[model samples]
Structures are given as C-alpha cells and as structure tokens.
Target chain A: MFEERLKEVQDAVEAAMQAAIAAFPQSDLRDAMAYAAQGGKRLRAFLVLESARIHGLTDAQAMPAALAIEALHAYSLVHDDMPCMDNDDLRRGLPTVHRKWDEATAVLVGDALQTLAFELCAEPVLGDAAHRIELVKALAVGSGAAGMVYGQALDIAAETAATPLSLDDIIKLQAGKTGALISFAAQAGAILAGADRAPLAAYAKALGLAFQIADDILDVEGSEETAGKRLGKDADAGKATFVSHLGLAGAKARAAELVAEAVAALEPYGPGAEPLRDAARFVIARDK
Target chain B: MFEERLKEVQDAVEAAMQAAIAAFPQSDLRDAMAYAAQGGKRLRAFLVLESARIHGLTDAQAMPAALAIEALHAYSLVHDDMPCMDNDDLRRGLPTVHRKWDEATAVLVGDALQTLAFELCAEPVLGDAAHRIELVKALAVGSGAAGMVYGQALDIAAETAATPLSLDDIIKLQAGKTGALISFAAQAGAILAGADRAPLAAYAKALGLAFQIADDILDVEGSEETAGKRLGKDADAGKATFVSHLGLAGAKARAAELVAEAVAALEPYGPGAEPLRDAARFVIARDK
Candidate 1:
C-alpha cells in the first residue's frame, strides 16, 4: 500500500514539474532543465507529501513545496555531475546535463533550477504570505552556505586532506550535506501549518543519516544498472564512509537502528504517520 | 555628488555583504564566495535604495533588498566567469573565483551565493511578510529561467548561430539578461509600499538598455586597464553588439537618448529624482 502511494506521488510530481518547465520559452536551456529534472525516485517529494497529509493538508496544497525540494535536488545533482565536480557521465539512467548538452548549458541549467526552486516556494496556494516566507527562509537555511553547500564543501575538503575523516567528522559533513534538506522537507508541513515541528524534525534527522548509510552500502554492493548511476565511487576514491568506518554488516545494523529510531519519532502522530514509518523501513531495505 | 552617494552605497553594501558571508563557516567555498562578491559598482543596490528613498523608506529599511540584488548579481558573475561559461580570468579588477580557487569551488560559490540572495530577501527588517514575499517573487522572476538566465542562454546560443543577432534581437536579449533585474531593483520600493511601479519600471527599462550600450561601447573603445577586464572581445569574436550594429558614435547617441527617456520617466518624482537622473547620465559617461 505504501509503495503504491509512493508511486502515485512520483508520477504526480513528475507531471507537475514538467508542466512548470513547459511554461518557460522553448530553448536549449529549458530543454536541458527538463531533462535534468526528469527522473528521481521523488523520495524528497514523498517525504513532503506524507508529512503534509499527516498535518491535514491535501496534495494540491503541498505540491509546490514538494516540487521545490525536488527541483533543488535536481539542481544539486546537475552541478554535482559537472566535469569539474564529480565528472560523472550518467545520472538517473541517462547522460548527465554536462554530457548531454555542454558544460556551460549545464551550469546555467543548475543555476536556473535553483532559482526555480525558490520561485516555487512562493506559490500562493501554499498558504498565507507569512507561511510562504517562513517556507522560503527555512529552505534557504537548509540549502545555503550553512546547510547542503557547507556539507559539499566539507566533502571536497575531505578528498585532499592529509588524513581520512573520522566517523564523527563524516557524520557532521553528512548532516549538513543531506540531513539539512531532508529535515527541511519533513518539517515543511509543520511550517505551513504553523504547528510543532520537533517530532518530524527528529524523524528526519535519523532518516537522513540512515539514507546516506544505505547509499554507501549500495555503492559497495548494488548493480550499476539498478542504481542507474556510477557505483563503487567511494571505494574507488578511497573516501571514508560509514561502511569504511564500520564493516558492511555493522553499517547495515546501524542503519536498521536508525530506521527504528525514525519509526519511534513518528509515534507522536500515531497511525496517521504510517506512510512515513513505512518510508523509514524502505530506506534501508531497498536494493537501490 | 552622485559619485559620492554611489560610493557610500557601495561601501555600505560591501561591508554588509562581507558580514553576511562571514557568518558562514570558513572554507575555500566561503572564501571564494566572499572574493567573488567583492568590488562591484553596486548600481543595482543604488537603484533599490534610491527608489526606496523616493517612496519614503529609510536606508535601513531598503538595505536588505539592495544587498539581495547585489548578491544575486555576484552569483551571476561567478557562474558567468567559469571555464565552461565565459572563461573569464578577471572580474572587478581581480582574479576570477575559478582562477583564484578551483572550478568546483567557483560553481559551489555561485550556487550558495544565489541561495544567500533569497535569504536576504526574507530578512524581517525588509518589511512585513507580504511585502517580503513580493520582493522574493519579483526577484525570482527577474533572475530565473525567464529572465537573466534566459538572456544568458540566448547569448550562448548566439555564439554558434549561423547569423549574428540583429538590433531588435540584441535588445530583447539585453532586456532579459540585465533589464529584468534592474526593473526588479527599481520597482522594489514601490512594491514594498504597495504603490504603482510603472514609472520606476519605465525608468529601469531605458536605463538598463543604456547601460548595455555603454558596456558595448566600452568593449570597443575603452582601455582594458580602465574597464578592469578584457576589452575588444566582442569584435574579436565577431559578436554583434550595439557598437557593431550602430557604429561607435551612433551607439553613443542612442545611449544619450535612452538616458533622456530614463530621466523623463522619473518626472513623476520631480526634482526629488535628480539623483536618479544623474545615475542615468553616469551610465553613459563613466569610463567603466
């Protein structure tokens, strides 16, 4: 049942995102943006919709925020895949923006996509002006220099450091890089409703770390075809990850523990948050 | 007198922007962002402050919006100077972000700076929630897919096109690339006051065009030392510019006419708009 609901969100978000891109004038830049945003699992959007649903908000009311997170995610991937960054050729089962178009187009595509994310956050249907401004501010805090970008900078710095990062350092880096955005998505519904966000924020904190651990595990064991991107990159670069600090078996155990923690954090909402509970379980169990 | 006012705005904005960047954790990314944001003419910020002043808003009230525009402008320059974009080495009389740091750092600096721009717009001191949302929305419209980026995409496309851009085509491109942001800055005060924005919008439209014409003229006739960057690149690449389509003298005359139109549009404010009139004159007369 949860899988079906997740699929529904994925389809809805994909269509809505396409419609948003279509509103722009036809050009290579627009085409590149559409291509870059095309196919993600939409986990971030799912998190947004589920959290909103638990808060008595309908899909239509929360769709803009969902799209905003996904757009921001897409922009990060586009820049991360650039020749000067990760130098990856594949993303979401197709050529990365830099590969399909050129580097310049890719850069503009990412820049424009980031702008689009903030633009979507200000959509009127979300709520009152105060609520929308709150969303915008929270998003900026979650994604800007102190958030995802900070984590990215740390990751790059780690690459050339004299020593591999310690376990605690890795956790700090991941918290900024991925945890911040996930926390923002999960807490968005509460922000929109002006309700207490502590429980959802806690749930997201554990879930985000678990998600990263799973990604590292996948990099070690998952098939490239299944992941739809390059695998084994971390091991190839000798970068320290959760699996590097803890053995694979230990890493899996820790992730399961995090999933349990995530599930417990949703107890405040009881059965109304079943979808989110299921999402926590799926984070570590999925092959990809 | 106008130069002094402009310099004062520049210094205030520079200090405020530095303080904002300093809040982020120290890293190459943070350093590069600070470096890239330093030393602009701050023309957009001046327009924002001047317009706000005309609307009875104080410098403290309008400063956030002004800083927001300058931040957005800085991000655009950082991305535009990347190896994959303009491949520029010099910006504002200093080494470009990518040259001083690495390509990855430059790209992330631009991304984070863009996020900072939106963050600044949401500053509570700017206004009430509704007014802040309006500023954010207008800024997104000005800088996103349909505005500055669209103009940039067109310029890149033009580089490899079979034919050079015509006079009308260049104007359309310039309007999107530079005019949109200038319009946003100029109209911000009216938006904050919930007043009619038509007059300021008109002034900005003409002023933006004149500014582009001046840039093109500088490319053709100004020295690289004075311009603080490469000159004659347009002619070297055989790109169509105002000076190419309308000869140097013709371009100068057209710029003068546009300045008059910009000044005339400000007649609604009568003598209180003298500083803005002087700004228009400065657009065409300045060496850089």
Candidate 2:
C-alpha cells in the first residue's frame, strides 16, 4: 500500500517538474536540466506528499512542495557529479549531466535548477505567503552552508585528512549532508497544516540518520548495478562511513534501532502516519 | 555626491554580506563564499538601496533586498569565473574564487551563495509576509531559468554557433542576461514601499542596455587595468558585441542615447531621481 502511494507521489512530482522546465528555451543546458531532474527515486517527494496526505492535504496542495524538494535534490546531484566534485560518470543509470553535456552546461543547469526549487516553493497554492516563505527558508537552511553544503564540505575535507572520522564525526556529517533535507521533507505536512512540527521533526531526525546508515550499508555490500551508481566508493577512497565505524552486523542493528525510533516518533500522529512509519522500515530493508 | 552614496551603500552591503556568511562553518567553502562576495562595485545593491531611499524607505527596510542582490551577483560571478564556465583567473583585481581555492570549492560556494541570496530575501525586515514573498518571487524570476540563466545558456550556445549574434539578438540576450536583475534591483524600493514599479522598471530597462553597451565599448577600448579583469575578451573570442556591430564611436553614441532614455524615465520623480539618473549616466561613463 505504501509502495503504491510512493509511486503516486513520484509520478505527480515528475509531471510537475516536466511542466516547470517546459518553458525553458531549447539548448544543451535546457536538455541537460530536464535530464538531470528526471528519474530520481523521488524519495524526498514521497516524504513530503505522504506527510501532507496524513495531515489531510491533497496532492494538488502538496505537489509543489514535493516538486521543490525533488528539484533541489536533482540540482545537488548534478553539481555533486561534476568533475571537480564526485567526478561521477553515471546517475540514475545514465550519464551524469557533466558527462552528457560539457561541465559548463552542467554547472548552469545546476544553478538554474536550484533557483527553480525556491521558485516552486513560492507557489501561491502552498497556503499563505507566510507558509510559502517558511518553505523557502527551511529548504535554504536545509541545503545551504549550515546544512547539506556544510556536510559536503566536511566530507571533502575528511577525504584528505590524515585520520579517518570517528563514529560521532561520521554521524554529525551524515546528519548535515543527508538528514537535513529529509528532515525538511518530513516536516512539510506540519508546516503546511500549521500543526505542531515537534512529532514530525522527531520522526524526521531519526529517519534521516537511519536512511544514511542504510546508504552506508548499501555502499559496503551493494553492487553498482543494484545501487544504480558507483558503489563501495567510501572503502575505496578510505573515507570513514557508518558501516566502517559500526561493522556490518553492528551497523544493521543500529539502523534497525533508528528505524524503530523513527516509527515511534510518529505515535502522536496515530495511524495517519503509517506510511511514514513504513517509509522508515523501507529505508533499511531495500537493497538500494 | 552619487559616488558618496554608492560608497555608503557598498559599505553597508559588504557588512551585511559578511555577517550573513560569518555564521557558516569554518571551511574552504565558507572562505571562498566570503571572498567571492567581497570587493564588487555593488551597483545592484546601490540601485536597491537608492530606489528605496527615493521612495522614503529606510536603509533597514531595504538593506535585506540590497544584500540579497549583491549575494546573487557574487554567486553569478563566482560560477561565471569557474573553469567550466568563463575560466577567468581574476575578478575585482584579485584571484577568482576557483583560482584561489579549486573548481569544486567554487561550484559549492556558488551554489551556497545562491541559496543564501534567497534566504536573505526571506528576511522579516523586507516587510510583512507578503512583501518578503514578493521579493523572493521577483528575485527568483529575475535570476532563474527564464531570466539570467536563460541568457547565460544562450550565451554559451552563441559561443559555438555557426553565425554570430546580431545587434538585435545581442539586445534581447542582454535584456535577459543583464537587464532582468537590474530591473529587479531598480524596482526594489518600489516593491518595498508598495509604490508603483513602472517608473523604476522603465529606468532600469534603459540603464541595463546602456551598461552592456558600455561594457562592450570597454572591451574594445579599455585596458585590463581600467576594466579590473580581462579586456578585449569578446574580440579575442571573436564573439560579436555592441562595438562590433556598431563601431566603437557608434556604441558610445547609442549608450549615450540609452542613458538619456534612462534619465528621462525618472522625470516623474523630479529632483528625487537625480541620483538614479546619475547612476544611469555612470553606467556608460565609468571605467570599471
């Protein structure tokens, strides 16, 4: 049942994103932008839409925020895949933006997509001006220097450090790099409905960390074909990750514990948050 | 007199930008962000502050908007100077952000700075919730795909096109490339004061074209010392510019005409618009 809902939100997010980029003039950058924004798992968008659904909001009311997060995620991937950054050649089972076009188009595509994310958040359908502004602010805070960017910067720094990061350091970096946006996504329903954000915030905090730990686990054991991108990169680079710090069995145990915590945090929402709870469980069990 | 006002606005903008970036974690990305944001002419910030001043808005009321525009400009410059983009090594007589650090740092710094621009626009001091959203919306529209980014994509396409852009094509491109943000800055005071945007919009439209023409003239005639960056780049790249279609003297005359038109657009404001008119003329007359 949760899988069907995830597909629903993903399809809706994709359509909205298509429409968003429809007006862009024809060029390699335009093509690259459309390409980069397509074919994501739409996990963030699902978190946003499902949370909103739990709060009694329709997809029509929630999809802009959903698309905003996806757009932001896509932009992050495009830039992260650049030669100067991750230097990846593939994303979502296809050539990355930099590889498909030149790096210059990739850069502009990323720049434009980032602006579009904030623009999508400013949509009038997303409640009042205040709510829209809050969405923009939260997304910026989640993705900016104090959040994802800060985390990425630290991750880069760690790659060149003399010693690997400890468990606590990896946790901090993971929280910033991956957990921040997830937290934002999970809190959308509360923010849009003007409800107490505490429960959802708690749920998101646990879920984001669990999600990253799962990614680390996948990196250690998953294949490139299954993951749909490069795998075992952390071990190859000698960079510290959750799996490296916790051991395979220990990491899996910690992830299960965090998932339980994530599910428990949604208790205040009762059964309405069942999809979110299922989402938490899915974070660890999935191969990719 | 306008120079003094520009300096005042520049200093205030520099301070606000510094504060905005100061809270970012101590890292290369943070340092690069600060470096890129510093030492610009702050022309857009001046337009925002001065426009607000003319409309009886306080610096406190307009500083956020001014600072936001400067942040946006700084990000544009940082990305534009990247190896994948313009590949410039110097800006404002100092090493470019990428040259100072590395290409990855420059890309991340630009991405974070763009987010910071919108984040700053969401400041409560910009006005009530409605006003803040308007600023964010306007800035997004001005800087996003349909505006500045579209112009940039066109510029990149032009570089490898079989035929060079003509004067008319250049004007349309420049309108998106350069005029959109200028239009936003010029309209900031009106937007903040909840006054009519038409006059300032008209003023900005002319000022932006004239500014580009002056840039072309400078590229054809001025030295790198006077331009503070690479000069004769357009000619060297064999890229068509205003001075190529219109001779150097013809470009100067057209710029003068546009300056007059820009000044005329401010006639409704009487003596209050003098600084803005001076700014328009300064667009064509200034060396850098």
Candidate 3:
C-alpha cells in the first residue's frame, strides 16, 4: 500500500521538478541541474504531500512545496558529492555531477538549483503569500548555517578531530545533518494549513533519527549494487557512526524503537496517517 | 562626497552583516562566511540604500534589504574565487575564503550566505508580506538560473569555446551576471514604496554595464595594491573582455557614455539623486 502511494508521489514530484527546470533557458547549467535532480527516493516530497493530505490540502495545492523540498535536497547532494566534499564520483548509480561534467558545473548547478527552490517556494501556487513566506523562511533556517551547514561543519571537523565523537555528539550532529530538512518537510503542511504542528514535528524528529540509523545500518550490511553507491564508508573513514558506537544489534534495536515512536506520534490522525506510519517502518526495513 | 557617503554606508553594512553572522553558532563555517563578507566597497548595499532614499524610505527601513544584497553579492564572489572558478587567493587584500579555510568551507559558506540573504529578505523588517514576497521573488529571479548563475556558466563555457564572444554576447552576459543583482538592488526601494520602477531600472542597467567596463579598464591599468586582487587576469587568460573587444580607449569612452546615460536616467529625481550620479562617475574614475 505504501509502495504504491510512494511511487505515485515520486513520479509526480519528478515531473514537477522537470517542469521547474524547464522554466530556465537551454544551457548546460540547466541540463546539469535537471540531471542531478532527476532521480531520488522523493521521501521528503512524500512526507510533504502526505502531511498536507492530513491537513486538508489537495495534492495540487501541496505540490510546489513538495517539489521545492526535493530540489533543495538535490542541491545538497550535488554539493556533498563534489571533490572537495565527499569526493563521491557516483550517485543513484550514475556519475556524480562533478564527475559527469566538472567541478565548476557542479558548483554552479547546485547554486542555481538552490535559488530555483526558493523561487518555486515563493510561487502563489503554494497558497497565500503568508504560507509561502513561512515556507521560505523555515526552509532557509533548516538549510542554512545554524542547521544543515552547521552539521556539515561539525562532520568535517569530526573527520580530523583528535577524539571520536561521543554518541551524544553524533546524535546532535545527525539531527542537524539529516533531521532538520525532514522535520521541515513534515511540518510544511501544518505550517501552510494554519494547523497545529506538534504531532507532525514530533513524528518527523523520530523518523529523521530512524532514517539516519537505517542509513548507518545499510552502510554496514548493504552492498554497492543494492545501495546504488559506495558502501562501508563509515568503516573506511574510521569515523564514529551509530553502527560503530552502538554495535550491529544495538543500532537495529534503537532504529526499531525510534520507528515505533515515530508511528505513535501519528496516532492523532488515526487511520489517515497509515501511509506515513508505513513510511516510518519502511525507513528501517529497506536495504538502501 | 561620494567617498564619505560610501564610507558611512559601508561601515553600516559591515556592522549589519557582522550581526547576521553572529546569529549562527561559532564554527569554521561561520568564521569563513564572516571573513568572505567582511571587506568590500559594499557597492550593492549602497545602491539599495541610495535608491531607497530616492523613494522616501529611510536607511532604517531599507537596512535589511541592503544587508541582504551585500550577503548575496558576497556569496557570488566567494564561489567565483573557488579553485574550479577563478582560483583567486586574494580578495580585498586578504586571503579568499577557500585559501583561508578549505574548499568545503568555501562552498558551504557561500551556500549558507545565500540562504541567509533569503531569510533576511523574508523578514518583517523589509515590509508587509506582499513587499517581502516581491523582494523574495525578484532576488530569486535575479540570482538564479536565468540571471547570475547563467552568466557564470556562460563565462566558464566561453573560456574553452573555439570562438570569442561578440560584443553583444558579452553585454547580454554581463546583464545577467552583474546587471541582474544591481537592477534588483536599484529597484528595491521602488518595490518597497510601490512606486514606478522604470527610472531606477534604466539607471541600473547603464550603471551595471559601466561598472563592468570600469573593471575591465582596471584589469588593464590598475595594480594589485589598487585593485586589491589580481589584475590583468582577462588578458592573462587571453579571454575576450570589454577592453579586448572595444579597445582600451573605446572601452573607456563607452564607459563614460554609460555613466552619462546612468546619470540622465536618474533625472526624474533631480537634486535628490546627486549622490547616485557621483556613484556612477566613481564607477569609472576609481582605480579599483
């Protein structure tokens, strides 16, 4: 049931993002941007659409927000994969933006994609000007220095730190690195509908933590073919991750607990949130 | 007179920017961002304030937009100085962000600064929701794929192209690359006041073009001490620039004519716009 809904929203977001890309003139920057944003799980978009549904917003009303989040995610990935960052040459089973084109292309494409996301977020299709402003402001806060960038800076510093990060430090880092945007995605519908946001925010906090633990688990157990990129990077980098700090069985148990917490957070919506609950479960169960 | 006003506004912008950077946690990313945004003429911010003054808006009412434009301009320069881009080591006679920190820090700093700009633009300090929305949309349009990034892309592509760009192509490129943000800055006051934008828009177009021509002239005749960065780079790269296409004398004459046009465009504001007129002339007359 969740797979069907997920695939539907995924395809819709892909098309919407393509149309957004089409608004630009024909150029390599446009083409490179489209390519980087083309393939993704669209998990963030799904969170946006599903939460919007629970808040009485139709798919059409919620889509630009959905697309904006996905585009923003794509921009992060494009930069994260650059040579000066993760140096990853592959993503989604294809050459990364830097490898496919060049570093200059990757840099400019990421920059342009980010601006495009804000442009889309400001569009009237999202709702009234107030709602759009809220999204724009929230997204900036989630993605900017105090949030994702701070996490990234911490992660980079951890790389050469004299001591490995403690479990608490790693948790805090993961919260910023991966959790902020997810929380924003889940709460977007609530923000837009002028509805209470506590339930969705709580659900996203638990789900984002679970999602990162799942990724850590995958790094240990999954193959490159299944992951569609490099695996075992945590071990290779000798960096402290959930798996290294918690052990294999311990990490799995923690992920399961977080997933349960995530599901319970949605009890307020009852049956209407079944898909989101399923999404939380899928977060841990999926190999990649 | 221009230098005194420039000094006053530049100091103000620096303080505003410093406060904005202070909001983020202390980290290398924050440090690098503050460093990159530290020293410049604050030309864009001045344009915003000067134009706002013409529209009967006080500096207090327009300060957020001024700081936001400077942040956006700083992000562009940070990225443009990266290894894959211009690979500069010096800016304003200090080390560039990448040289002072690292490539990842440079990239993330630029990204965060861009996000910070949008966040500031959305603030209530800018005006009502409608005004903020207009500012957000125009900034996105001016900085995104069709504007600054596109010009940067064209520049990178022109580097390896078999043919040199024509005089017209370069002008069109500059319009997007350098002109877009300046136009946005110049029209910001009118947008906030809900006044006619035609005069400011025309003034900005000519000013932006003249600014580029002056930079080209500086590349030919200015020194490192005067320019505060590398000089003769266009000639060193053997790339077509305004000076290359139009000849040094012709480029100077063209810039003078553009300054005249820019000054004439502001005739609508009469004596209230003399400072702006001085700014236009300063664009061509200054060594840097």
Candidate 4:
C-alpha cells in the first residue's frame, strides 16, 4: 500500500514540476531549470503524502505541500551537485544540471528552484495564515543556511580538517542536510492534519534518523551503476560514514534498529501510522 | 541629519554582522564568513534606514530591517562574484571571497548569508508577527528566483547571445535584479510604519527606478579608482546597459529626471520626506 501511494505521489510531483517550468519564460534558464528539477526519486513527496494519508487527508488536499517538498529536494540536489560543492556529474541516471550546462546556469536554476519552494508553500491551499506561517518557518529552517547550509559547511570542513569527527558530528551534519527536510516532510503533513505536537514531532525525528541511516547504508553497498553516481565516495574522501564507523553488518543492524525506533514512535497514532511504518522499512530495504 | 542617521544605521548593521558570525563555532567558516560580509557600500542598509526616516521612524527602530537588507545584498554580491558566476576578483576594493578562500568556501559563505537574512528578519526587534511576515515575504521575492534570480538568469543569457535588448527589456531585467530589493526596502519601511498601501507603493516604485538610473549613471561616469572596482566592464563584456543604449549624456539626463520624479512622488509626506529627497540627489549626483 505504501509503495502504491509512493508511485501516486511521484506522478503528482512530476506533473507539478512540469507546471512550474511552464510558468517561467523560455530561455537557457528553462532548459537548465527543467534538467535540474526532472529526476528526483520524490522520496520527500511520498513522505509528505503518506504522512497526510495517516491523518486521513486525501491526495488532493496534500498535493501542494508535497509539491513544495519536492521543489526543495530538487533545489538541494541542484546546489549539491554544483562544481564547488558535492560536484557530482550524475543524479538518478541523468547528467546533473552543472554537468549539462555551465555552472552559472546551474546556480540560477537552483535559485529558481528554491524560490519555487517558498512560492508553492505560500499558496493558500495548505492551511490558514498561521499554518502557512508555520510551514514557511519549517521549510526555511530545514533548507536554509542555519540548517542545511550549516551542514554543508561542516561537510566541507570535515573533508579538510585533521580531526576525526565523532558519531555525533556525523549525525549532526546529516541531520541538517538530509534530516531537516525529511523531518519537515513528516511534520508538515502532521501540521496540515492538525495533529498534536507529541505524535507529530516523534514521527518527524525518528523517521528523519531512519532515512539518514538508510542513505549511509546505500552508500556502502550500492554500485555506481545502481546509484547513478559515484559509490563509496564517502570512504574515498575519508569522510566518516556509518559503514566505515560501523562495519557493513553493523551498519545494516543500525538501520534496522533505526527503523524499529521510527515505527515504535508512531504507536500513539495506532493503525493510522501503518503507511509510515512501511516507509521506515522501505528506507532500509531500498536498492537505490 | 541624514548623514548622522546613516552612520548610526551603518554602525548597527556592522554590529549585527559581527554578532551573526560570532554565533557560529570558531573555524575557517568564521574567517570566510567575516571576510565576505564585513565590507560593502551599505547602500541597501541606508535605503532601509532612509525609507524608515521618511515614514517618521527612528534609526533604532529601523536597524534590524536595515541589517537584514544588507545581509541579503552582501550574500548576493558574494555569490555573484564567484568563479562559476561573474568570476570577479575584486569587490569593495578587497579580494573577492572566492579569491581569498576556495570556491567551495565562497559558495558556503553565500549560503550562510542567505540564511542570515531570514534570521535577522525573524528577530523580535522587527516588531510583531504580521510585520515579520511582511519583511520575510519582501526579502524572499526581492532576492529569490522569481525576482533577482530571474533577472540574473536573463542577464547571463543576454550576455551570451543577442545584438541588443530593448529599453523595456533592460528595465525589466534591472527591475528584477536591482530594483526588486530597493522597492522592498521602501515598502518594508512603510509596513513598519503601518502606513497605507497607496503612498507606500508609490514611493517604492519611484525609488526603485531612481536607484536603477543612478546605478546606470555610475557605471558610465565613475572612474574605476573612485568606484573601487572595474568600471565600463558592462560595455567591455558586450552586455547591454542603460548608458550604452541612452549614450553618456542622455543617461545622465535621464538619471536626473528619475531623481526628480522620485522626489516628486514623496511630496505627500512633506517634511517627513526630505532625507529621501536628499538620497535621490545623492544617488544621481555622486562622483563615485
């Protein structure tokens, strides 16, 4: 059921992305913009949609919020792939935006994507003025300089410095770059559903950590062919990773532990949280 | 009065910039962050302060908004001067951030600046939730992909292709890149004043054009020595400019006309608006 809903959300996200590009005037900007945005897994969108489903919210009701999350995910990827940053040449089996165009185009396209995140969030569909305000705050903290930006800073610093990073340092970095948005996806869904803070925050934190651990495990086991980019670049760069810090078996065990913790946190929501539980399992189990 | 008030606002902004950087953990991030942010014209800061003054607000009440605007301007300059973008080697008579540090550090610093803008705007000193919301919205639109980002995309595109851009096309591009924030500064001041829409918007629009024309005139007549950076690089790069299209004398005349028009629009405020009028004169008549 979670897999089926994920596919539905992916389709909605693809359509919304196409609609957003249509809003811009055509130029090289449109080409770079479309290329930068096109190929994400829409994992964030699914998290938003699935969490909304747990609240008994229909797809139509959750689509705008999901689209906003997808836009932000796409934007992060665009900036992350720039030559000065992560510098990846491929994403999801396609050339990254900077690899396809000059760096200027990629930067501009990324900026456009970031604005689209806010613009979509500001649309009146999600909730009232206060809810929209909360949503904007969440998005800003999740993706902005203080959160993801700080994480990227630490990632770059970690590469050059002689000091060995603690497990906590690694967790802190990933939490900002990857965890913040993932948590936002879940919390935004709960916010839309008007759920109480206890259940909302628990799901957000646990699921965010689970998602990050799954990503680490994938970096260790996945092939470049499968990942559509470099694999184990983390180890190559001597940046600490879950697989290196913990052996491959230990990493897998940790992932499972994280998923269990994630699912346990959803117990308060009872049967309404089945999709979120499935998602936690899927994060650890995915091949890509 | 304007000179003293501008200095006070500048000092406040300088303090705010230092405080923001001090909050980060000590690292090279601190050095790159400080280097990128510490110097600039403070034009955007002055705009906010001057606009507030026109609305009968004190500098103490306006400093937070001014700092926020300056942070946005500084971040834009940092990103724009990056090797991937403008490849500029100099800014404010100092080495560009990317030139001083690695390109990666420069990129991270720009991201930090972008985040800091929102952080400053969110400060309690900016007043209540509604006003904070207005400031955030204005900053987002003025600097984000749809406005300045869109303009920048077009500007880059314009450089790589085309024989000429029409005056209207140039105005639209300038409006997005330069005028958007200037307009935001004017409008944000009015919002803080609890002023009505008609006067606030009228002032914003006029100030926006006046500032753009002044920038054009500066590019044409200001010496590289006095301007603290390369001059006539716009024509050198084969990019279209207001001066190139209007010719030197014609551009100057048009700029003066814009200043007059901007001051005329402020007539409704009478004595409350004299500094803004002086600012317009200062804009078009400055030697550097």
Q: Give a tens-digit lDDT track for model 4, residues A1-288.
A: 777877877787888778877776666777777777776678888878877777777777777778878877877787788877888988988888888888888777776777667666655566554565567667767776657777777888788879768888888988887888888888877777667656656766777776777777788778778778777878778778877787788878888887888888888888877877888888888878
- The DockQ-based CAPRI class assigned to model 4 is acceptable
What fraction of the correct interface contacts does each predicted structure contain? 0.86, 0.79, 0.88, 0.33
Candidate with maximal TM-score: 1
| Per-model TM values vs. the true structure | 0.99, 0.98, 0.98, 0.92
Question: Which regions of candidate 3 fall more than 4 Å away from where they truly are?
Answer: none
Ranked by TM-score, top first: 1, 2, 3, 4
Tens digit of lDDT per residue, candidate 1, span A1-288?
988998999999999999998999899999999999998889999999999999999999999999999999999999989988889999888999988899999999999999999999999999889989999999999999999999998998899999999999999999999999999999999988888999999999999999999999999999999889999999999999999999899999999999999999999999999999999999898876
List each model's interface RMSD.
Answer: 0.6, 1.0, 0.6, 2.5
* Model 2 lDDT per residue over A1-288, tens place: 988887877788888898888877676677778889998788899899878888889889988899889989999999999888899998888989888888889989999999989988888888888888888889999999989988988888888899999999998888889999999999987778887889889989999999999999999888789678998898999888888888999999999999999999999888878889989998998887
Q: Can you list each candidate's DockQ?
A: 0.90, 0.82, 0.89, 0.44
DockQ of 2: 0.82
lDDT of each residue in B1-288, candidate 1, tens digit only: 999999999999999999999999888888888888889889899999999889889889989899899999999999998888888999888889888888999989999999999999999888889989989999999999999999999999999999999999999999989989989998999888778999999999999999999999999889888778878889999999999999999999999999999999999998877888999999999887
TM-score of chain A, cand. 1: 0.99
Q: Which stretches of candidate 1 lie over 4 Å from their true place?
A: none
For each candidate, give the TM-score of chain B. Answer: 0.98, 0.98, 0.98, 0.93
Q: After superposition on all CA atoms, how large is the RMSD of candidate 4?
A: 2.6
Task: Give lDDT: candidate 4, residue B190.
Answer: 79
In order, what is each prediction's RMSD in angstroms? 0.9, 1.1, 1.2, 2.6
- In terms of lDDT, the poorest run of 10 residues in model 3 chain B is B124-133
